[model samples]
Target: MARRLFVENGFHATGIAAIAKESGVAVQQLYRDFPAKEDIIAAIVEADCERIADQNTLNTAVANKDRAGIIGWLTTTPCHKDESGDRMFLEIAAEGARNDRIRSIFQGIRDQADENISRAFAGLMDSDMVEDEHRTLAQAFMIVSFGSIFLRTLNQEPVTPASEKLITCLIESATP
Candidate 1:
């Protein structure tokens, strides 16, 4: 409920009372569950990262060292009609720039994501792909993927083949 509210209404506009009303929980319970709005966004980001890490397709691609598959999934998944998750992610990103607490959460998410992407890169490439190479590629992928996703969502554009090709090209360029 907090996630939905935060995504739907701007975080600043969504209050405890609104969340409680939307969730059918008492305000006190909501507060007990999450001490503050930052807590909610942090939890949401953490859960999202965990869910993506555990996604069967993601696990299979990583386990199989399928770089192309991961890139395809990352670039295409956010094109869904309901872009609430992507929007919330963008929201958190915007908030992160202005708030230290949100920025910390973003850093945690980035670290976790980097580790996962590094593993994937390691699996995809041969022994020549060292830890530093993996980190570089992983970080590049995140920068491009997240920036592109946020921009595309903000522009309300449909996912075009050109955009898909751009991601593929970017990933290929950074691949070890």
Candidate 2:
């Protein structure tokens, strides 16, 4: 509910009272749950992080040292097909630009994602440790993922094909 409101009306434009009203919860109760609007936004982002940050598949592939499995994972963009979700993310990103708290939240997500991607790169190369090359490729992959989300949300064409191509190139180059 707050997610929808944030996407439609934006972070600053959407007030606690509005969210409370929209969610059919009393403002006091909402306050008890989330002291501030930032808290609500944090909750939303945390849920998204949990949903999208599942590294089990990658961990399994890495544990088994499956190069093909790692490549398959790398090529698959996790960007959801839901435009609303993407819009919500864009909104949060915009807020994060000016808000320190939001920026910290997003930074944490980025750090975790980078770590996971770097580990995956190490796995892809059958290396026990992540090298500088792996870290650099992880950073690039993160950019591609963010770019794909932005392009997809904007209804731009050729995002997937281009993103896939870039990812494949990255994977191929990273392969030993």
lDDT by residue for model 1 (1-176), tens: 88989988977899989988988999999899999989888888888876655556766776666767766555544333347878888888888899999989988988877876666656566433448877877777677667666776888876556456765665576555
Model 1 misses residue 135 by how many Å?
Answer: 1.6
- Specify the highest-lDDT model's number: 2
lDDT of 2 by residue, 49-108 (tens): 777666777788899998887776676645445677778778877889999999988888
**Model 2 reaches what TM-score against the true structure?**
0.93
lDDT of each: 0.73, 0.85
Clashing pairs in 2: none
Each model's TM-score?
0.80, 0.93
Instruction: For each of the candidates, give the backbone clash count.
Output: 0, 0
Q: How close is candidate 1 to the true structure, as a TM-score?
A: 0.80
- Which pairs of residues clash in candidate 1, taking residues 3 or more apart in a chain or in different chains? none
lDDT of 1: 0.73
Question: For this target, which candidate reaches the highest TM-score against the unseen true structure?
Answer: 2
What's the lDDT of the predicted structure labeled candidate 2? 0.85
